[model samples]
Target: MNTVQEAKRYLDNAREILREKAHKEEGYYLDTKYVKMAGHTAYVGVLVALDGLLGKKGKGRKGVDWYNQQLSGLDKRPLRSFVGAYDTLHLSMSYDGNPLASVAAAGLAEAETIIKWVESRTVEA
Candidate 1:
């Protein structure tokens, strides 16, 4: 499959994990482990979509700095979305394991935005 498909699968898997395993109670998830897993999974999906559009820098390994730099040069709008994804998906959910349902919702929405933006660009190219 293409990068868009692959990236979307990652996101789908993340949603499934949250829906099936995270054990949501009202507006929060009870399982921090599952939350972390889903966050990491979704964040990776964002990276995959971005990489598909940006290509690899081939500077040993990639990091947030590299991604932000490339995206900032390309377009500031998507750059903001990506930064939000990193903060919400990567840091808040993945590391801190924030249990707020709204946090996850916002993060997931941001991931979707980045992936769709990448898809639009790739399809146009």
Candidate 2:
């Protein structure tokens, strides 16, 4: 729960950055990517909390495997798909060559969606 609170703070900061970037005509694009990643990280934090709330955090494999297992049961297809897409984008952008502008934009959108989902789920959790 404390970890969730901290993650929520970070998520709030990411949203603030995104709101600022949205106001800019041509903002710092990479910062937008960072915001997306930050948002995803926050989502992960929320998942951990929710899993604990639901008593499913340690029921499966550890780490991302456990995360994926929980994600597999979600009823929200769009959110699940966006999370999968962002997972791919995060790996690509972190380890491979630079991502295209469109990829970054897509990642940002996915991150934003995930953040919104986290916000709603956290309340329910």
The residue pairs in collision within model 1 are none
Query: Mind giving the per-residue lDDT tens digits that candidate 2 earns over 87-114?
Result: 6444543333223445545554555555
State the TM-score for model 2.
Answer: 0.50
Q: lDDT (0-100) at residue 60 of candidate 1?
A: 85
Q: How far does residue 27 in candidate 2 sit from its true spot (Å)?
A: 12
Q: Give TM per candidate.
A: 0.98, 0.50
Residue-level lDDT of model 1, residues 39-101, one tens digit each, is 999999999999899897876889999999999999999999999999999999999999998
* Clashes per candidate (backbone, < 3 Å): 0, 0
Candidate 1 local distance difference test against the native: 0.95
> How many pairs in model 1 have backbone atoms within 3 A of each other, for residues 3 or more apart or on separate chains, i.e. clashes?
0
Instruction: Return the lDDT, model 2, position 40.
Output: 54
List pairs with backbone clashes in candidate 2: none
The local distance difference test score of each candidate is: 0.95, 0.50
